[model samples]
Target: MFSTILVPIDLAEPESSHRALDAAFHMAHEYNSDVHVMTVVPDFGMSIVGGYFPEGFEQKALDGTRQRLDEYLEGAVPDNVDVKGHVAHGSIYEEILRVAKEVGADVIVMASHRPAMRDYLIGPNAARVVRHATQSVLVVRD
Candidate 1:
């Protein structure tokens, strides 16, 4: 049984994320748990990329992502579900794992795409999360 559930999605590509979110909600409902819907914005860690953007880009990005996440969940999650939205900036998998720990999530439900050679080389976020997560992770393929 889970107390807190973490559902991570890619806002840019939410093709199959809905499936994972639905599953998480179902589980949360069954267990009387709260769902934490989270998404990560890629950090402009490199100085070169940071220089290309204007000042306060990171804050702007976080704010924009927060708004988008709210809008996204408005239609995606049902009103009855006890849900919270979170935005993080950094590596996708790392942020997800961090949020899971931060929220004391007992389970993480996420979506994954079909593997390609490039994905195997660099590894996908879902794969990384599966490997690194301290709690249970259910990966639903897109």
Candidate 2:
């Protein structure tokens, strides 16, 4: 019985998270749980990378991501489901974990794509979240 479900999705590749979102919704409906959907805006990896962009670019990106997250939930989430949206900046897995703790999520439902050789070398965000999260995680394959 999950009372709070947190789903982290990549808006750029929303199709990747469809199954996970559906699974979270199903669980939410079953347990009358609140759903927290989140997306992360990755920071420019280096200070030089930041210098390449104009001032306030990060803020603009964050604002735009928040808007997109809200629009995504408006269309995807059912009216009956109690859902909240979060937009974060920084490492995807870290932001997800932070939000999960912030929201007191009981479980996290997220999507994982088929592994590629590169993923084996450098783990994907889902793998990182699975390994690091304090909460239970259910990874839906895409």
User: TM-score of each candidate?
Assistant: 0.95, 0.96
Candidate that would win on TM-score: 2
lDDT of 1 by residue, 15-125 (tens): 787999989988988999989999999887777989988999889989999999999999898889878999998988999999999999999999998899999899988
lDDT per residue for candidate 2 within 28-120, as digits (tens), equals 989989999999999887889899899999999999999888888888877788788888899889999999999999999999989999999
Per-model lDDT: 0.91, 0.92
Give the per-residue Cα lDDT of candidate 1 at 92. 86
Stretches off by above 4 angstroms in model 2 are: none
In model 1, residue pairs whose N, Cα or C atoms come closer than 3 Å (at least 3 residues apart or on different chains), thus clashing, are: none
